[model samples]
Target: MGRRRTVHKKLPAHMHRKGNSYYFVQMVDGRRSWVPLGNDLAIARLKWAELTNIGDAEVEDITFAVAVARYRRDALPAKAAKTQEEYDRALDRLLAVFGKMPLDLIIPQYVRKYLDERKAKVAGNREKAVLSTVFNHAREWGYTKAANPCAGVKGNTETGRLRYIEDQELLAVLDHACRPLRDAMEIAYYTGQRPSDVLKLKRTDIREGTLFFRQKKTGTALRFAIDGPLFDVLLRITTDPIQIPAGAVRSLYLIQNEEGQQLGYRALNYRFNKACKAAGIPDFQFRDIRGKAGTDTEDVTGLGHAQRLLGHKNRKMTEHYIKERLGYRVAPTPKLLIKQKKRA
Candidate 1:
């Protein structure tokens, strides 16, 4: 009287074979959904058994996949949208390799092997960090008794981005940029804010002759007075507002397209890249504008000034950010006093 299984006849109840992968059909939020149990039949069988008996089992019967699923349900939503996207990607790789493996069976050697074998070294480092968090959660959930395997593993070495945009290069890029792109570029440079932060700016953020910013990544709140060149740019944007389409809500964002919609990350990036190419500037990114602001501020005043301007918590970070983009500047040694002493 029930649906008959003609395929994967050896598979247990509720297990369905599709393509090279196996899925377990279960009720999720009152709807039947297919949860991937991986391609290996042995591993899929183990996962299915664990999933079915999860409510009546001890920690020893739990799999890493169960822990990952619980984490996704309980913790993943708390992260920022961009952060959630990143974690989702990292978790996919981790789940593929460790999903059906028992939590206690994961060890330092296995963690290191995964890191070593991953092609994207930097991305592997990020995924390993996510894995470490998962392990921590697994311990709390009583899914694992073993310590986190990723604790002792070292990530691959990473080099900081050091490209600094010169004044002429910025001007050249500006010449090739469209109105919206030019506005975005000037705001990024003058405000010395991240590209995302710049695009998030709303007209309401300007209050009492100050532009307020609350950095999403660091939770750093900063306010810059509306004066000098910054005032000029803001005035230009206000006087030449983008034309809004009929029946569409006007965008509140400082940088918006002709349709009066907020400029998306992809659109801004594409325009920026095209402008850079037209300017004949290679290896230049929009983020480099913030670095130029730091370097220029340090040059005009001091490192402390740059640090404050960039909202860095410490001088070391600010120093590293600015570095010697245009190479080091050295003062000539003062005239020696020994010659006058010898003449005397």
Candidate 2:
């Protein structure tokens, strides 16, 4: 007679029950394993169906490794490269923390605990945002039915402590900086453009005494009319040509050092901060100089004009720059403010 069949023989490829509530599925290869399906019976059933349809004649024998390979091949390519990178990183972190916990056993509370632990180690709202996005993607791809644990997690609020140099501080810092850093800082301060845009600036971008280029971050075309002081600075740095790898150098915004290499934004930032410290100007961030410059331009050109120069998506952001730098007060006009009637 044939040997009596055991329960383990029926569900052979590492199946486990969780609290009499759900099923967990894993595929193991000796010691290594993966939880390919977790949480709900419906989702587990669907994944099983998918596995069988894919020619896994014995769905009961499907391994976690196979499920992981299939999921990555089918689901990962659908996401953007940057997004995929973030998801991969998050998964790495998850695996480090949970290390092959059965998928069905990963309750919402387990995820919440993981997040709380990570929150202490990861320093920034960005990490939290990335985690939230990954969990959302996992749910959308049918990896889990549980709502994203990160949904209600609060992100750290960025406190805006404007580290803007006043006119006198700017003058002092610039006077002490080396020529390359000074020029770069001046352009950032004068134009209110991002460091990336300022670094990529070229001579050809300047036409009719105005610097014109589409901002790299926002793709908004900005035009800043060059004036006497800015022109003087440009004239001081205009010298020896830089050989381009592909095409001819088109712009003169990035002045090379004596070594003839372009000044990277990182180097520029470090040198700029050093100059600020030497000048005894505390809290003078590179970006604050841009705000100061924008505030100055708002008087020359209207706030709307300054808004475009700074490449702000809207006037509201531009207004914040103006208010912080110029101390421009916004109170309701007498015409709009309600006044008390004369006392009887």
Candidate 3:
């Protein structure tokens, strides 16, 4: 697509004509800095006027920290709760570097310095992304007119770092995992659901043979047939007399603590990590089980079914799992059934 400059036929409210050209009498540095609106009043009135309308008074004192706070209160809530938390954490790291700087003063050079000093590239990249959003919001709010500093910055590659949980790793984790942790992992792997989602699964979500709920992150209503591992495990948990504790009420959740409370991520991680150590397994995350579910049965059920299983909005996410975690499967070399003749 070709870029087209927009033009507004009429001049804006603050703009006035000086000699042959239009100019804006707006505040800058606590005074009116006569900004040249340009000879073509139409284009200047459309493109520049919309993204930035900050007066000099607003620009004089607006700092990066102030912009971040506004973004936190106003723009952050639209994201998922988990995503909001992650972005907030990344924003804190950015604030540490440029909290005192004015919004317009934070240029690409300063951002590049921050990226270079940071050892963890993925986290740094996320911080850059969050800062970019903050600046964009600031522009819309008429706080600053600077371009997004994160526009051209590239994040470090995290390829080949993620690996799927092998069957042995599963056995090890299960052997040492508490009942709640074990149930969480099992459900996550079997259903190809996020561990976060699995941790919140309630017993009431099951009806007949189908489990249904709206996923927290995506808000997509999910319905999965409860069969195979999911069915067998849930049946045992509900029907087995020994599995139920004496005098304890059956929990409302499928994967809750002994007190029927939803399991916290920190507590689950600690227990899962301890179990992994006990089983002499390497550092494989429980979340990696999601990737295993995508590839393990996909050869038979196909990618579409696997995509649905993972609750991915698209197949691209599922494909990333198959390639990043599983890598490509090596096909068998062809062989001749009969003896080959001597080369001609």
Candidate 4:
């Protein structure tokens, strides 16, 4: 028979090494339990000891599950709804792959593998970038001390394709569109504002025949005077005693239906695409009109000015729009010098 083991009266609230691995042996009075360190035994023991010494620290292991919960509650902001939603989705992806591993077990290599697996499924540079951001935030919050798993990870190098409508197609579509959609399309063209922003225009945003509003996406305040054609279009669409519901009465969207409710972006996109088909406009997209309008107005407002009015955060975005709208191609302009006939 094996000899009876002796129980210590008091247990040490620290981790210690056992043979080749580390173990966290905890004892509260006479009760005792131990957990093994899978791979990072040394580092795990040090972390466990440090946390225990910091009085009032919870004894439970800090798992990825706990860290994610903290990220959702303490890190994300209320105003950034879209960002929060994306973070939640990314964290869910991480959890599915890691399965509630200890927080410290999430090394850069593990993150890299997770990203690689996700890239195979989603196949977008943006998704990879978002994943990188999430892991970076995790590091910033002290959930991990390892290098970012997404750091130095290269993504597919393809740029997005630009789709635009020809002038004739645009004209045809405009001629066939219903009043609300027609005004919406025309305003998107003239103002170069995104569909979401255009749909939120209020009658009050126009003052002395000029349009002014703070862009929601980029937070840029814009002011621009409208031309006669655009002014006429606005006058045609204006409504008296705006009919929005009492709950949304204070909202300042200039474009509203008979009920005074602003048109939803998806609905507007669907209707606009339908309008294009009805008008027999081939290869036309709603966003193309904005680019076309900006190109046509380039002389009046420089490319930079148009880009700012469009609420583009960077010049490269403006350049892409300009290139697509104007069908611009860059080539070296050769410089030729001829000895002017001194005789002349």
Candidate 5:
């Protein structure tokens, strides 16, 4: 004979029935605070959910706006300037939509809806990243203990940056680019380094025949050989007689504004964009030059040999750049199948 089945009854959290009334167990000051929740199990369940989700000692009843404000005030200043700026842009959109929403209620589904409404993929992704950072900071600062809403919601497919600078476009843009942007673009092109890393270049970073520095994002120590074009740009900037500020040191940076100081990433981008527009080559950007280097290097030396040029520790990341330029279609054709008849 089969063994007798043992059964366990399911109960709504913190709920118990007595006669026609239902009571909920609410924790208060290490004591049970029995709250009346009426007789209907559905009503009791709703009441239980409401009470249980409320903030505990570690978590606070903080709104998303207040939490975000705290993060903006206390944490963002300690981050890299580039990172702060990007997060600031992302926050601009988030605050407009979820400023008053409770931090604990903003789940993955809510964030997905926010992402869908964004027209640009990159914009949506940036906002999602910023939100995650906000929640992480909130948890540490005792704002809320809810899981980050941005989790499990994947970012949109990024539109690959395909604009590469050719010889003619480079010449035209260089002819019109301001002094700061000219040096910035040329360095990025010759060395295949990020504009952020290139803009942070100090005059002291050059040694022997290579430019050596720790990459800002990855912390990878990179040493790129100074090609002929890079040497030419270096020579011009090194020799340029710019008026140094009252307290600023001369020759401190590889690229500088009119006042001899390190160029900022934001300032470089604004000026570079204007230069591209003026040169009738508005499509080209500073990053496109970096991509051009990757494409050119991959063609000449193959993917493995081009690894050092981009300063990536992993070859997979280096290959991503090369693959973008290859223009290879990813969609495969479906295999045709012939129908077969079966007989008994």
Candidate 6:
């Protein structure tokens, strides 16, 4: 019913060339749907057969690119902004390797090979996780009938961060921090909250002599009594004179820039890194402050106190988090044993 293409006349029925690329044309719901079969004629022919073979009609055939597009449309919107950014980065790497491959053809061996070849082992693990999710969604969408290929694959080994900021290191870094950075650091250190939680704090979060925190990552709600160092930090934030930039209203967030805008992640990271560089403490990160709080709390009080401060669900997790920072000390000398032996 359509005009025969004069150019690429040698192309098979239902196949057409547009620019440099080939397409497989099918009528779906009475409208022509053009599925991309890529640019190479030989590979396009192979993909065309995969799509149109009578024996394979029962199983939906689509490339990983198509499936990823569908996934980005349907799934990525539901994730948090930070998580979406992480997945987007992973997806870019995954698409380069498997984009043209048929979704059902992506086997476990291929997944393993990709992981082995990737130079960034830790980042490869994250990309593998994103690929696994794509396969899962592909199955649900009927694009593939096979089980997810990434299920049994073991990712590269990764160790937890073990750096601890000493008291002098903290003081040095604090000396170089700006007003907003100082406030953010003290809040993070005293409350033992994540950087995200610290930035999200507002005047409304404090009520009736207690500061409340609802962790963004874990949804763990914590309440800290307003006392001691935490109390001093909060008082400073409240009593300090804030210089608002022209045409910018005061921010609802506790941490704000000179412009009176809520401190964003990029700004916060830049300022913290600059301060660290100035202090000559390049190894220290803003996150290590939380660990310091936990370690110091455990030393002064006990493990339970540390667990509560860090908002960990259990003491075991708290122990693992603080163990590296709890540098070894000689066990108390056996004075009681000596006394018992003397009496005997």
- Cα RMSD, each candidate: 7.5, 13.0, 14.8, 13.5, 18.6, 9.5
Candidate 1 local lDDT, 285-332, one digit each (tens): 999999999899888888998888788999998988887575556787
User: Which residue runs of candidate 1 sit more than 4 Å off their true CA positions?
Assistant: 1-57, 324-328, 335-344
Which candidate leads in TM-score?
1
lDDT of 3 at 222: 81
Q: TM-scores, in order shown?
A: 0.81, 0.60, 0.75, 0.66, 0.69, 0.78
Q: For model 5, give the 10-residue run with minimal summed lDDT.
A: 2-11
Clashing residue pairs in candidate 6, if any?
none
lDDT of 4 by residue, 1-344 (tens): 42333442111234455666656667667886667654453345334544454323242465555554444444554435556556555656565666467655666566556555654544435555655665566667665665665667666556554665667788888888765677788888878777777987887888886888787778899887777777776766674434556665534566655565677777787778888789877567777776777666664667788677677888888777777646664577677566566674
Worst 10 residues of 3 by lDDT: 2-11
**Global CA lDDT computed for model 1:** 0.85
For model 6 the TM-score comes to 0.78
Flag clash pairs in model 2: 27-64, 38-104, 39-104, 202-251, 202-252, 203-251, 203-252
Better of 3 and 5 by TM-score: 3
Q: After superposition, how far is residue 249 of candidate 1 from its true place, in Å?
A: 2.6
- In model 2, the runs with Cα more than 4 Å from the true position are 1-122, 139-142, 207-209, 239-253, 330-344
lDDT of each residue in 130-228, candidate 5, tens digit only: 888888887787776788888799898887776756778888888998778888888887788888888778878988988886888888897767778
**Runs off by more than 4 Å, candidate 6:** 1-59, 327-344
Q: Compared with the true structure, what per-residue lDDT tens digits does model 3 show for residues 176-209?
A: 8888788788888788777778877777889878
Q: What lDDT score is found at residue 194 in candidate 6?
A: 90
lDDT over C-alpha atoms for residue 222 of model 5:
79
Candidate 6 lDDT (Cα, 0 to 1): 0.85
What digit string (tens of lDDT, one per residue) describes model 2 on residues 271-319?
A: 8888889999867877777777778888777899888778898999988
